[model samples]
Target: MDEALWAVGRGTGVAALVLFTASVVLGIITRSGRPLPGLPRFSVTLVHRNVSLAASLFLVVHVVTLMFDPYALLNLLDVFVPFFGSYRPVWQGLGTVAFDLLIVIVVTSLLRNRLGPRVFKAIHWLTYAMWPIALAHAIGNGTNGVEGWFLVLSGVCVLAVLASFGWRLSSRFVEFRSVRLGEIS
Candidate 1:
């Protein structure tokens, strides 16, 4: 039973990471203002929102399962309180900070309308920070380390982020060209 729970927790964590990667990619593409041919804007937006929600859900499961795992020796406070983990204090603290950032991002998104567009957008940028913090936690404390399928998954996540960022930059170049052309015209 314990093994089963641990496996499930690990799977959930992996799934959450993958969902976050996808969210970052889609967000960059959309923010570039370059419409994807044949893809409705609403559809892309919906996918981005749903992916964020799914990532959050998986994150919650990962945290809860770790707290319950007797071997992990994590308590509820460890989840909420930064750097309180009895084991691997520094690395574990990264997870706590990441959790806090995730909460901020998710809450702001949920109340985006009430928060207004500018405020909501500002908070939303925290997602980029959250990604690196999460990545650091995974790298510093992940039991799997640089082995098996885990390395491949991490590579994919990194590639997705970089690729999206590159696309956004390229789109900006295109926009600049168009603007220059208009000015000349």
Candidate 2:
């Protein structure tokens, strides 16, 4: 049972990583105001949201499974308080930090309408910090982080993010302002 829980935790962690990577790439695409092949421009944002939700689900499962797995030795406090775990405290703490930041991002996004665009956008920028922290957690804490297969997976994810980020910086990216001050009347 412990092994099963550990497997689920590890598997979900990997899944969350991949989904988060996709979310980041799609987010870059959405910001560029360009439609994916056969996708309307607006649909890109929908896809990004769905991917992020999926990643969140997987992350939740990963954390929950770890909490239940005796091998992991994680308690509720460890889940919330960064570096509070006895098992590889620093590495586990990174995951906790990433998870907490994600929770903030999700909550702010949900209250975007009530919070106003300025506040929402400022909090959304935390995604930039969240991704790298999550990646570091995976590399430093994952049991298979140093394995060949996991390294390859991480490499691909990194390359995809870098390419997307480069495109985001490039002038070739078309900017489409979803909101216009003049139109606000």
Candidate 3:
């Protein structure tokens, strides 16, 4: 049972991170306004949201299983409150902080109509912060952090995000230049 719980936690955590990486890349793709083949812009938004929800579920499973695992020594407070866990407090606390930011982003998104665009947009931007924080948490706390395969996986995820960021930056620059040259209104 203990081994099963540990494996489940580790598996779910990795799944969540991978899904999160996809979501971030897709979010950037959507923002860049580059229509994917056979995928409309709205579909991109829909897919990104769905992927994020799946990742959230996996993260919940990861946290719950770890909490139940005796080896983790984690309590309820440790799950929500940062820097108080007995095991690897710094890394664990970063996860806590990322979780808190995720809650804000999710809640705001759900209440977006009521909150209006500005607030929702502001909160949604936290994804940029959440991604790196979550990545650091995983790298610093993962069971297989030192493994060659895990490092390669982490590198791929980082590259995906960075590529999206670079593409988005260049696209924005082109748009700004177009505006300056009266090429676009």
Model 3 steric clash pairs: none
Cα lDDT of model 3 by residue, 14-40, tens digit:
999999999999887766555579997
The local distance difference test score of model 1 is: 0.80
Q: What digit string (tens of lDDT, one per residue) describes model 1 on residues 69-119?
A: 777778978998889898787788998898899999988888998999889
Point out where model 3 deviates above 4 Å.
172-185
For candidate 1, the 10 contiguous residues with the lowest summed lDDT are 171-180
Q: Could you tally the backbone clashes for each prediction? A: 0, 0, 0
Ranking by lDDT: 2, 3, 1
Number of the top candidate by lDDT?
2
Model 2 is weakest, by summed lDDT over 10 consecutive residues, at 176-185
In angstroms, how far off is 149's CA in candidate 1?
Answer: 2.2
For 1-185, candidate 2 gives per-residue lDDT tens digits of 88999999999999999999999999998876778999998999999999999999999999999989999988999989999899889999999999999999999989999999899989988988899899999999999988999999999999999999898889676555742223221
Better of 1 and 2 by lDDT: 2
Model 2: what TM-score?
0.94
